[model samples]
Target: MTTSSSPLTHFDGQGQAHMVDVAAKAATHRIAVAQGRIVMMPVTLALILAGNAKKGDVLGVARIAAIMAAKKTSDLIPLCHPLALTRVAIEFVASPEDSAGVASLIDGETGHVSCTATVETVGPTGVEMEALTAVNIALLTIYDMCKAVDRGMTITEVKLLEKHGGKSGSFVNP
Candidate 1:
């Protein structure tokens, strides 16, 4: 597990929740990337890949939802600073087989769809939350779009892949 030497910044000595002040910090270019995956029935994945989902264009709509979610992160999370985002990129990939390299079997057949979101901004604080938010919204969009057919779809491994800029410096998941 990863450990931090510094104390949590979102709380004061009294343990009251509060937003961290970044006004005194200098503006710098910041970027963060987050990713997640959804596992669903192979047939459901086929429907999505074949563009036959009842909702229409699942990935395309999810991409747009991710960008919008990144921009609106501050509104969704109270402690987050509202910074002017410079860029947001969302990508989705569909895999016919699971990571275990198992081939599609009758009832056990499964498909994986992954979403990655990269968010960039020039500001005092980092955009980690924005990137994470984007990934979550994207996955949720996928779930919403295909839930009628695959109610058992599971979203997993939602996490920050890396981050750059800010006083704390850079971090990459190992």
Candidate 2:
């Protein structure tokens, strides 16, 4: 929350989660990167690669969905503060996509299509939730588009990869 001692920012002394008061805090350049992936059959991956999925452009649509979702993070989650994000970049990767890790092509049966959202804003609060929401929405979009062909698609590795700015300064996940 406030980078104070309290472990949770969304709650009060009574522990009921509330929107933390960010009005008093100084606005800073804050950024958060969130990432996740959808694991599917090799055929599903081929369809995405070939742009032959019945759902139209899979990664293209998912990218837009993620950015839109990040911007609407506050509305989607009750406790989140609606933030004016400066940038929301959704990068899609096909695996064995090692680098940024949006998608992967590890084994024969599983193919990963990962989405990473980088959210930036000059605000008092962090964009971690927004980033996370973006990643989730992106992965969900992928699942929805391909469900007819691959109902077994699993969303995994959804997390805030890192955050910068604000009182916390910086955090890199290990």
Candidate 3:
């Protein structure tokens, strides 16, 4: 059954559940950051900005949640190798688009709430998935916690912003 990289070691071509062997792979530092956005009404956005979203500390809780989720990526996503994350950071920022002296979003809406998650590790594999997962989980948490205030919230543009320190090298979004 030995073929190419070998049948026992190479599982991608076999279509079976098998953990990748990293014994021969060199260990290197890895880091990745992902970002996303949640759009909602201006009033709803104001409630969050004022720290009165009824859910209490929306960004604070979401940040913590993202960090915790990143640390437990393996448990949440099947097939993901359990990793000891060296560091995980999640951030939230309000992005309001204004055109000169004109109001943005027609009715002066809050535009969007940006959520970013950065993950780092010192291991053989990469942390891109973990970082992206953290951003997703955090955005979902924000939606869940603020649904009562704004049911129309939409999450968009969830992507890896950048990654560095790996055998395959670094990646930056254009």
Candidate 4:
């Protein structure tokens, strides 16, 4: 469980779960970036690299899934507000070079592909949930598409790398 200095935003002062009213808040440009990795056997990696997965293009399908998931974040997560996204991007790389939206990719013996989701919106609410949802869905889709080839695949390090806009302003994971 996590605790906050202030009341949890999803709950009212009375401790009841509720959708936050952003009617009084000013609309601002909001953006969020998230990343996660799916680890699998080297053989499975080779299959994906060779486009031999039985379920068609794994990364291609996952990229679309991530974008769609970001747009439908409100429907999937209770208390989240739906926003008209300005931009959404999903990228995957075995070894990433640090850039504005992507985090420093993990370098390890485990064969993993890093999936990064970047979401932007002009609204009263932030798009952190949308970015995170996109990453989660992307990772899950990768697992689903590759399950037959490697049931041992694991989704790990799902995280909200950064967020910008709203009253809280910008935040980046250190």
Report the CA-based lDDT of candidate 3 relative to the real structure.
0.81
Q: What ordering of candidates by TM-score runs from best to worst?
A: 1, 2, 4, 3
Better of 2 and 3 by TM-score: 2
Cα lDDT of model 2 overall? 0.87
Per-residue alpha-carbon lDDT of candidate 3 for residues 1-174, written as tens digits (9 for 90 to 100): 333454554365545557777767777989999999998887777676667878798888888889888988889877678888999988887766444412244575456789988899998888888998889888888898899978899999999999998676989999
Error of 1 at 62 (Å): 0.5
Q: In candidate 2, what are the lDDT values of residues 76-125, reduced to their tens digit?
A: 99999988889999998787544653334545658887888899999899
All models, RMSD in angstroms: 5.1, 4.5, 4.0, 5.4
Measured by lDDT, the strongest candidate is 1
What is model 2's C-alpha RMSD?
A: 4.5
Better of 1 and 3 by TM-score: 1
Model 4 TM-score relative to the real fold = 0.88
**Better model by lDDT, 3 or 4?**
4
**Candidate 3: residue 66 Cα off by (Å):** 0.2
Q: List the residue pairs that clash in candidate 3.
A: none
Which is better, 3 or 4, measured by TM-score?
Answer: 4
Rank candidates by lDDT, best first.
Answer: 1, 2, 4, 3
Q: In terms of TM-score, which candidate is strongest?
A: 1
